[model samples]
Target: MMKRNRSCVLALCVAAALGTASLGGCSVGEALHEGVTAVAESASKAARFDVSGTIEQTTMLDNDVLTVVAESLEYRNDVAYLKLSLTNNTEGTIDVTACTGGYDANYVNDCMLSEGYFSCEIPAGETAEDEVDFSLQELQLYGIQKISVLGLGLRVVDEEYDELFKDMVEVKTLLYGSEGVDSSTFAGSIDSPALAEKLEYEFKAASTTAPDLAETDIEIPAAFLFINKDGDIAVMAELRNNTEETLRVQAGNITINGLAAYEGESWSGGTVAAGKRGVMSLRLSSVVEYGDLLFDSSKAAEDADSTEGKEGVDLSNVKEIGMTISTKDANGNTISDPVDVAFAF
Candidate 1:
């Protein structure tokens, strides 16, 4: 599959981060088309969430009137992502122009997705299976969350979407009557019972135990899942830019939950610079056992018996992970042939 344009996506991130009405005042629907060439590309990043057989948060709305399977939610860099499939078994097509993924009882905070319709459609009896990338904005990336939506009515259908946001950021559709009356309504929040359930369901996915990654020009040579010396749970990857040209790492993410932010400003796995070798440290959202995060192929045989009898922590839970490293050159051309790197502990 081909990748989406990167420059356009970063532009949207800048607009959303700045809270501009039109991608910094370019107008809502227009922004989605222009920037989506970039954002929609992240869905390719969705493959990183392919936890094979793990069934995470599978919830139904109004007894399957709308069923949603939140296949997985992982934290990469500073973004909170929800890779899900929502089926609309209701009466008519529920056009979700925009969405607010509300994670709390009170809708005070959320990862707002105004360009959702560009990515998918739940046209009555159909399912929209696309990964949603939510900007952390003011929310914590590692917490359990829900998806919500709001949008507009079309008088003049734009190439990007039906209508514009008009700076209306409310989840008004949660009230039901607002759907067809000129604009979109906020789909009501789906409240879960407990936080622990949210955490377990969202992150439960099939993962690799001992990763054997193929070689790439940009490679993650050494990976570790360990409590850093500073006492924070961390995923440290030593990335090397084997290419001779100065390939800039456009974005970096280690999707395993925990580790809210990447350690540095430029590269998450430390600056790859023009040279080939460097280390990138993703600070975990929370702390984990020192041993579990430190396991790999060679050490597994020795630690197998030692980790089994250990109480309190479950070493089996620390599954292997897939790392995504995107890079580009001076000509704005993307470096291709991506191979999965592993932090198989």
Candidate 2:
């Protein structure tokens, strides 16, 4: 009797699976398909951190030559990623130096020496897809409502445009900063109003008002020298810690005489032991046509020697080196007020 009961049960299960009975009436193929589909849907949901509804498209122009379009910015695994594309319409390449990525208005960059992105080239008459990545795990931990990426400048490398000011190739910035249009020798005209506007922007930024570091506790115990040696110009200074505690001095967004001396890199800055001193310097390199100068201190140590007490350092018609050096604490939080130390030349 028991064997008869077991045989009846087995027959009923086979009938249901074969779709011959009303008990859930599913075929073997149908059951297999449904099970696989359910598993796939769950795995698909688990794979992605959804930002489909969060991203927005943005368009930015780089000196009227290159167009940068950014979209689908998302963060995962401590890296903030952006889908960016560049279309270069002009006849030259665009030297994109940096892309300032921030959360809300907060610049996630702790030390001003953030190389947002560099050495990335966009050739003319070409469209290229670029991926920009930034590490922002701390920002995520603190929480973020929005993400913004800006502060991008492109150096247009065109032979035609460069030829327009061949006479000013070496001393263009020095001339412009010292004499502006009055020094008509280097201030040649560009037919493109857009290019003119961009030049004007750079000029204004590089030669802004001199900073007043008097309000801050930081001090430069020695006179800073703008030196010329080995075909390189460098600024050497001593960062003196006036505070009772140690200081991690950070200098970024550096500009000199209305031009970018150094951006996206620390300029003449470092840590000073409690009431002690540290070396701060910036070694500069750039095309002079842009009517500005920049300083890179992170690499200044390599070029620091042979510049000490160097008599050949030129200071003619000099103005100021606009910079902001901040003092950071043990937790990397900015503990003191920003030190706007625009060393006058």
Candidate 3:
């Protein structure tokens, strides 16, 4: 009976051993499968955030203008290093989840994600740091010509995380051109009044004309007579040759009106040469006060009709005057038609 019991015990022990070996082999296979899956998942995650380090050889186009260029970008393996310095200029503590940065041509609405680019989250009134690395192959496939750094994304834990970060926060992207040089910074606000003032000044300066002299001779008619706002009257009875050489004169006379207080004070002096006409300013000492000056067109017409022997003529009623100038050749012969000047007060 003892021998039979020993044989049975040995058989039972062998069966138990075989069962244990089979279980161990199955466990090993399961572990190997799990290990492979974990490795693959880790590789995928690494590829997603592969953007690391700095972009090199960047070029900036039209520094002050809207155009910018990037020559080259550099990265550490497949990882990108991003540093953000944020300041809360607002009154309240602002929580930010993510920020975006990229090339904006219009700088208004057109912003696109660059290669291997993504958004992150930041806390209100607190600075946050993030490290990202993406797949090299994916980065090239995205055709990312520029970069935009963004914040706020689907939270890893819960959907409520979306409201944690608001888009009110400002982001200043310090981009280095392909040459590894810093580009100009741009602000997002607009000051319309200031811009308008600058534009006004630019137009004013452009409209002001400089004095120019005529390159040819000019002539004047005998009927040309002028009275200025200052009450000064000038009558050209004959041609006055002030130059030594015989030169042609273009017809024109400068006059001033001294009687009309609102006309202000003006004067002009220059020599008319044989083949050149001099330009002079008819400036007013002060701008005429509005509503203080009166003009009489009837008196001007009367004066225009008769020049007989009028001296110290009362021109207070004169609202307008006419003067004519005709250019003459070297021999004092009239050239082209006469140019007329009409003055109104």
lDDT of each: 0.33, 0.37, 0.25
TM-scores of all candidate predictions against the true structure = 0.26, 0.31, 0.19
Q: Which stretches of candidate 3 lie over 4 Å from their true place?
A: 1-74, 99-125, 132-134, 144-345
User: Which candidate leads in TM-score?
Assistant: 2
Sorting all predicted structures by TM-score, with the top scorer first, yields 2, 1, 3
lDDT of 2 by residue, 1-345 (tens): 000011111112222222222332212222212211111111221112122223456665543566667655666664556566767677776544342221101122111112234334567788777655544421221122123222232333454434111000000111122222121111121112232232121111122233555444566644332221112233444445566765566676665554444554244344444554444545433212122333343334344354531222122333556667666653356765655556554
Quick one: ranking by lDDT, best first? 2, 1, 3
TM-score quality measure for candidate 1: 0.26
Q: Tens digit of lDDT per residue, candidate 3, span 13-115?
A: 1212222111111111222222111111112221132233234433322211111223333456533333333333233433322212111101101121112
Choose 1 or 2, whichever is better by TM-score. 2
lDDT of 1: 0.33
